[model samples]
Target: MGGIDNQKKFVLDWMDNHAKELSDWHQVIWHFAEPAFREYKSSAWYVEKLRAEGFEVEAGSGGMPTAFMAMWRNGAGPTVATYVEYDAVPGNCQAATTRQEPRKGLSKYAPGHTDPHSALGMSALGGALAVKAAMERFGIAGTLKIFGEPAEKVRASKPIHAAKGYYDDLDAAVSFHPAYMLPMVNTTIWDTHCGVGYNYIYTFTCDAPQDWIASDKYSPIPQNHLAARAPGANDALIHFYTLNESLRRSMLPFTGLWSFNEAILTAGQATADNLTPQISQIDYMLRTDSIEQAEIISNVMDNNAEAAAKATFCKWKKTWVAKSRPGLANHAMAQATYDNLILVGAPRWDETAISVAQEIQRNLGLAPMEKPFLPATERLTSPQECERLMRKQMPEWQRYLTSDDYPDYTWHCPTVRLIVARPMLSAPQGYTYPDWVANALGGIPATIDPMIQSAGKTIGATLLDLFTRVDVLEAAKVEFEERTGGGVGGSKWMAPLLPKDFKVPHQYRWPEYVTTARGEEWTIPYRDDE
Candidate 1:
């Protein structure tokens, strides 16, 4: 193989050469703005691109139609994998301008990138392609795996993939996210990592509408009378919703950081008939520091669903959408990743980028600072310091502050979570810009390109090192084994929380864009004339 330095140089140069291509890819994804599990167009584009780049692409893997695994190997060595997330959040639809305007001809409730998975996915793509180019040019022996993960906004896909043994063979993996409240210019998560998170959909169906009136078959009213039928699925959904809220406070200790939030996935379908409403769904998501805690919460929620179903004369079925373990720490991988991050440096913003941010501030009626970007964007932060700062705000008993599914990858193989800066306007002292301002900046090329390029280079360099430098990969493995007791089957290691045959919940009635008689529109339906 060529010298390590030469390989690194080649990868960086390749990334620079393909900068525009990466930017264009990011733009396309940003424009698509597809939401969880429903990212059909976004996943198709990635699969097509990966295939064109010579990777053996699986358009859908792990039973998820929008999830894929793309592999490119050269003579086999350590397998290094990176993942991409393309799901956007609903109600974040905003144009790429400084003003808070939704996309043209789309409603404000349409999905848009809040965390901006567009940059995140593009960075992973750029890194993988750059590393592939270097591996071929330098005769580097290894395999590269790229995963297209969908529904990340709800912490979906990764757990399902890991449970089905999709991530078992990897020597190491890398994950990335755009900087939000935290200013992670060039840093990896230190400690205080994410905890266990669970997602479930309780589907209440009134399929046996006749059963409701079975006990009163001899009532004075005729059997076909609407009054004889029970209050249907809508009542069951309301009871479940109210009962779950009432039971939330009893699910976990208030001392630690834990939460339970619910969303009504489907209420009764639009109907004017007096007939009983047939179907309804409610989704519940919870985050806790340990799997035990998550289980306790789940049991309580299940019980509530049963009671609600009985009272409302409906039958309910629960589907596990996501179950993620707490993050595992790897010092060796973190140090190696941090070293590469320092080499790549922080994202550099020029006049064009700064002007866009300043314009956003001005539109928000706040005076633009001389430096429109966050100071952290121009500096490097150690993971240790980042963790220290993060922990300071967190309560003493809270081991994990937030929830993310990436931790699932850590148990199977050593994984590094990389955080790179994305541009955010530096508001005037003691003032805050509305969320749309940040969302707007994420779609603009000038403001977000620095982050995309810097992250791509950092990821590419780190992946290249693991491919060529056997010692670095071995060191990461040693740390992984020690932490995981003996390794994959170690005593301390935790198995996937999901069952192997667990069905993927992509078929659920999730919110998505739809075509209506008025024209194409969001599922919630917004009229342009309104």
Candidate 2:
């Protein structure tokens, strides 16, 4: 109930002054809505802004085209790091409207921010800028590294950055993700943080269709219906998919919540070719609570790929995409972030925001509530409570669930995972709201600005605390060292899952907006003209 100190006040006031700028930046990214590995415009904008702020910027950091690293320093002090994610999810192109509508001049199935990375990126930027303001005014000494990470939905860039020594020199890290679940609305991860994830692509190739049978000796024409054609890459992909689907149950113990999903990157898609569709690529990403479980499932998948390739007379190769280790908990860092979150308080919605939620409910043909926003978004939830809610649905022995690349930084330095409130609608019993409602709210300034403002202030104050409170930072470091054996090289420490010479799987075709003779349109057209 008391007032905040002058330094924290200064940080909060900085956030207030720049709140509009943050909202506008969020709008820019929401409109861009570029999906994984193709965030050219979003990354360029961040690089330009960081360079203008007097930070040394690296355009392409970690060999990922849309990933970057920027640093601002004030003499010699502790080096703390934070990162931004801008890549939107594919096939979720919802416009900022009460109804289910896509952005103007784009297809309905184009990319949009499902997790609303738009707010996440802008809030972090506002915080970093505010931190810069405090450092300049109070003459604080430290380093701030703002990483531009792309393809976070696929968990792509961070692991690569960590493996390449991007996070090795950090003293601590601050990570922010927009809240998703109800009970975890304004809380950070506790004991069982995100787990291990493995992403790999199986490429099947058919080089010789003629080698299936001695066609030349029996018949002169090998391409006609007179001879049976050899099973090619398409069949290989089908076999791989079906075979994996069949063996999915036997791959691992059905103890914890694990998942295996595949997306066909390139397989006789959008075209019916007479030829043997020479090449096909399918992506598989699975989540498990432990690395040992991940390894078991991955081994089964690898064997399935080989069998499918052999059965279809094709050659198959597995390419590494991403691997994220289970997150390590730092009680000290957690306490620091929660303290700052308390200082900043939860995001409060205005009547205008409530009206917007009601409008969305009406558009969905559902009755609206007097207070349409979910209660959790307006109140704080402690870390312990959040951990309880997170594990309520999991089995007892499972240590982790889902997966996030932020854990990669935890293995290197004391890292804090900050979860802030994002607008979510409350629904009537047995009635569900479409995902577009949340997506639309994320884009509207009235609904999303409060979240951005509070998150920015929390981040600014927390970073300022690390610079000023040596005891807290040291305590976090000690806790981190104790967890990872002795430190980075200590026992029980986990190294980067990626190999030294791992190549990024960027050569495959990914969906993106394109400009042609018609206009700037989705690569796969779904409009009336088609």
Q: Please estimate how well model 1 matches the true structure, expressed as its whole-model Cα lDDT.
A: 0.86
TM-scores, all models, native as reference: 0.94, 0.97
Candidate 2's error at 162, in angstroms? 0.6
The weakest ten consecutive residues by lDDT in model 2 span 268-277
RMSD to true structure for each model, in Å = 2.6, 1.6
Off by over 4 Å in 2: 1-3, 216-219, 251-253, 269-273, 526-529
Candidate 1 segments whose C-alpha is farther than 4 A from its true place: 1-4, 183-185, 210-229, 250-255, 516-519, 526-530
lDDT of 2 by residue, 167-190 (tens): 999999999989976677787777
* Clash count, one per candidate: 0, 0
Worst 10 residues of 1 by lDDT: 217-226
The models' CA-based lDDT, in order, is 0.86, 0.86
> Under the 3 Å rule for N, CA and C atoms, how many clashes does model 1 have?
0
Of the candidates shown, which would achieve the greatest TM-score relative to the real structure?
2
Which pairs of residues collide in model 2?
none
